[model samples]
Target: MSASVGGAVYAALAYLAWGLFPLYFKQIAQVPALEVILHRTLWSMVFVMAVLLVLRRWAWLGEVLRQPRLLARFGLSALLLSCNWLVYVWAVQQGQVLDASLGYFINPLVNVALGYLVLKERPRRLQWLAVGLAAVGVLWLALQTGHIPWVALVLALSFGFYGLMRKMASLGALEGLALETLLLAPLAAVALGLMSWQGRGALAQGEPGTIAWLLFAGPLTAIPLLLFAAGARRIQMTTLGLLQYISPSLQFMLGVWLYHEPMSGSRLAGFAFIWAALAVYSLDGLWQSRLRG
Candidate 1:
């Protein structure tokens, strides 16, 4: 029981850190999103490699490197992850954090659909209902806004596919992320080098504060994920599922209250439908867990 409580706290902290990511990204808003992503990829590789070195976690990495098929799979996952990161940074910089939060809010539903389609896992009736409700909510938002929420959809789909790839990955979270960053670091370093040569790199010409924030990206990208991995290993899946909402909920609040993003009645209504769907999904998950227990 004590371990469970500790796990819950760890998970909460992880989600809270993720929720507050907009603030971090906002600090680097002056930097180009792609450049920021490049720096992130580069620094995160450095930090995670240090972690693996300290822990002597090299055996599994060698095994994975021996398998070309595994390397190719992680390479694709890395691309999807980078795409997700780029979109998220762009969204935050564009003052569309609310839309970004909406993407995460709809992510579980996307996961459900992905499971059904890709993994051939059948969701229960309540899960299907939840997915339908979310779709309707997304549709309503598109109709009311006179356009689709492409930012939200792209973030959702990219991250959803990233998650799918990770689910099939053999490495643990730390190792998987390390390998992904390793795959991406070369291209990222080249991009940064090109930017520097052209006198456009933030690290080369930006303010000291900006350079510090960019450097902080290493731990900023890695710590929460490590915390999440620790928590996930110790907690029940149902608890983890419910806790996942904390990040998006905080992001939504930050968007509306802190950032003062416009929240129209139509937008609120659309969010209301999504919130209702989440309620159904959460309740059903809890109920099913109780039955299984």
Candidate 2:
């Protein structure tokens, strides 16, 4: 019970940090999203590598590098992860935090479908219903807006695929993230160097405050993941699934109340459907877990 409480605290803090990510990204909104992502990749690599070195966690990395197959797999996961980060940062910069929030709200359902399609794992009847309801919510929003919610869809799908890849990965969260950053770091370094040479980079041209914020991306990207890894090991899957909603919930509130994004009656109705879907999904999972125990 004590372990569970501690895990809940860790998970909550992790989600809170993720929820507050928009505020951090907003501070660096002046930087091009691509450049921001490049810095994120580079700084994240440096920070995570430092941690791995301190922990003497170099063996798996060497073993992974030896296997061409593992490298290829991690390379693909890295690509997906990078794309997800780029899209998310772009969305926040575009004042589409609401859309980004919706994407995460839809993500668990996407994960359910991926499990069914990719892993041949069947979702229960209530889970299918939950997915169907989320689809309706998305469709309603798209129809009301008279445009595809491309931002939300891209965020959901990219992250869903990234999660699927990681689920199949052999490495722990820290190690896998380290490998992904290492794979992308070289290209990210080149991009940053070119931007600096052109005198167009935030690092070289921006205010000292801005530079500090950009550097903060290192811990901002990593600490929550570390917290999440710790919490996931200690908690039940059902508990973790419920905690996962906290980030998007905070984002949604920030978008609506803080950022004053448009939340029309139609939009609210659409979100209601998605929220209901999540309730059903969570409840069903709890029920199943209770049955197993």
Per-candidate Cα lDDT values, in order, are: 0.84, 0.84
List candidate 2 stretches off by more than 4 Å: 1-13, 227-242, 289-293
**Residue-by-residue lDDT tens digits, candidate 2, 1-293:** 68888988987898899888999898999999998999888999999999998999998877888999988998998898788889999999999999999888777767777777887877789878887888899899999999998988888888777767766677887898899889999999998998888888887799999999988898888788667666755664435546767888999999989899999999999999989888888889789979978
Question: Candidate 2, after superposition: displacement of residue 124 in Å?
Answer: 2.1
Q: Report the lDDT tens digits of candidate 1 across residue range 139-253.
A: 9998999988998898878877776676666778799889999999999999899888988889679999999999999999888866766665566443554576788899999
Q: What is candidate 1's local distance difference test score?
A: 0.84
> RMSD, model 1, all Cα superposed?
2.6
What TM-score does prediction 2 earn? 0.90
RMSD of each: 2.6, 2.6
Model 1, TM vs. native? 0.90
